[model samples]
Target: MSEMQDYRSSLSDPKSRKFETFSYLPEMTQDNIYKQVKYIVSRGWNPAIEHTEPEQAFNHYWYMWKLPMFGEADVDKILAEADACHKAHPNHHIRLVAYDNYKQSQGAAMVIYRGPIKV
Candidate 1:
């Protein structure tokens, strides 16, 4: 039974990378991304967007798209901002962050767009 189990090796390429938790899963669709943003807004968490070049992603602090959306209840607006950021920096990795005010910390984060991997 052990032999029948499937096993997969981890990526060994130095350039091959993973960012936030969502990166490990399959690419999300527009509906899926909308759902995620909705979840964050439902929790009353502030949504923010950030971006960074593929190479700088692991080292430097990501560049904030704009100020965090405090008291933002409209999920569509949040998604629009994220989309705008992605459109502005199509070659950079785009991330969505949720700030939890009560906890004074990040409640959730995910890389929504992956920049092209430079070979």
Candidate 2:
């Protein structure tokens, strides 16, 4: 628990290269999102995360995230999280683009941000 908190606290550090961003796409889903998440993960950076519009998030017509890509080693965990998003919201078809914190894939990384938020 403390370790996670430490990592979160470290993000606010100005010197830290953990910059975060988002893309509001309305027609996005797991199918299209896989690539983007894969790409970010491949870059060895974990994008930030945000769940804004809690009510409409992954339900109506919106999706939000914070891309805080720190490094390339966190791809595996991130990819799993992305995969979980699809399973969690299979009906809503919400895609999860993220900066992974673990890596366990091929040297060929993937990048394509398209999910339930946009086309």
Expressed as tens digits, the lDDT of each residue in 1-119 for candidate 1 is 35663334234553546677787677899899999999998899999999998778887599999899999989889888988998999999999999999999999999988888876
Cα lDDT for residue 29, model 1?
94
lDDT score, residue 55, model 1?
A: 73
State the lDDT at 116 in candidate 1.
86
Steric clash pairs (candidate 1): none
Candidate 1 Cα misplacement greater than 4 A, ranges: 1-15
Q: Report the lDDT tens digits of candidate 2 across residue range 1-119.
A: 35533333232342222212323223335555555656755566545433332224333344443343356445556656545554554434233334334563333322222223321
Instruction: Write down the RMSD of all candidates, one decimal each.
Output: 3.2, 14.3
Q: Supply candidate 1's per-residue lDDT for 36.
A: 92
Q: What is the lDDT of candidate 2?
A: 0.41
